[model samples]
Target: MSKDQVLDPGAIAARLADLPAWKEADGWIVRTYRTHSWKGTLMVINTVGHLAEAAWHHPDLTASYAWVEVRLTTHSAKGLTEKDFALARKIEEVVGWQPGLEGGALEGTPSDPRFAYIKHGR
Candidate 1:
């Protein structure tokens, strides 16, 4: 819950192996992408719907013709946790987001072409 406490990289890495696109942020994990159009956004949403149902976890999503932003956090944990990291990884796997991208809650740059710009949010 408190950012002051550090999460163990080994344990977190094990849980995050399946999720390559998501990354640890200050308090949460996130991913973002550009959709081809409005319909593409709907398609992405529908895909996430199935993923959410399967994982029984959901993310905060904002979508438009050009972009979709996904943020995952464990509200109950009040900060990053195993659950949050797990979901973050899963989303990345499903969406094909590369790690160390700017879309996460941490600071970094990405060399991928899908994202025009990626950044962390408060």
Candidate 2:
């Protein structure tokens, strides 16, 4: 696939099929990850930054106490390209990552495993 070539509708749809958590909006593919705490939100943002830097494909990120939205598009190519999907896949791999292997998920407690996968309740 050409790195700079913007994908057509059929191609974009086919690629997007694999990314169930993502949707195209306003000429961009986007996904929002929901977390249980501020720590989780921050962790997601940092992880996205690492992925973007590693892939050399940056994305627009909006982060809050319980949510982080990642928007991907290739500005240089002026549209969506293979690079966007590639980076999105990489980002998805660890976006909802629970960092227990790094010794506690969020620096709160190893006992509670920090704030990951917390269920919502009224």
Candidate 3:
């Protein structure tokens, strides 16, 4: 099917299998990223904003002191589409990256609670 076409429940489920943190709900694909503080929340929001803008597909965001929920759908298509899934993957990658785990020169946020940022899943 075309990328812009609305995905059926079966297709959505298959796609979601590749995105463990995301789910289909109320015609949208959603995911919530937990952070350590307001600062981390803002960072998550900004990161998503940049990704959405770059992809030219935006998502609705709900932010709290320590979390940000992203809801994405193809407004024009009136349902979930490839655009939503692609953007979701990009957002997931950037937001969940742990440079420290890669043993790269760039150390991720310090392990100390005071310096912690995103609460990455183990």
**Which is the leading candidate under lDDT?**
3
Off by over 4 Å in 1: 1-26, 97-122
Candidate 1 global Cα RMSD: 10.3
Supply the global lDDT for candidate 1: 0.60
Deviating ranges (above 4 Å) for candidate 2: 97-114, 117-122
lDDT values for all models: 0.60, 0.80, 0.93
- Return the TM-score for each candidate structure: 0.57, 0.81, 0.97
Give the Cα RMSD of candidate 3: 1.0
Report the Cα lDDT for residue 74, model 2. Answer: 96
lDDT comparing candidate 2 with the true structure: 0.80
What TM-score does structure 1 among the candidates reach? Answer: 0.57
Note the clash tally of each candidate.
3, 0, 0
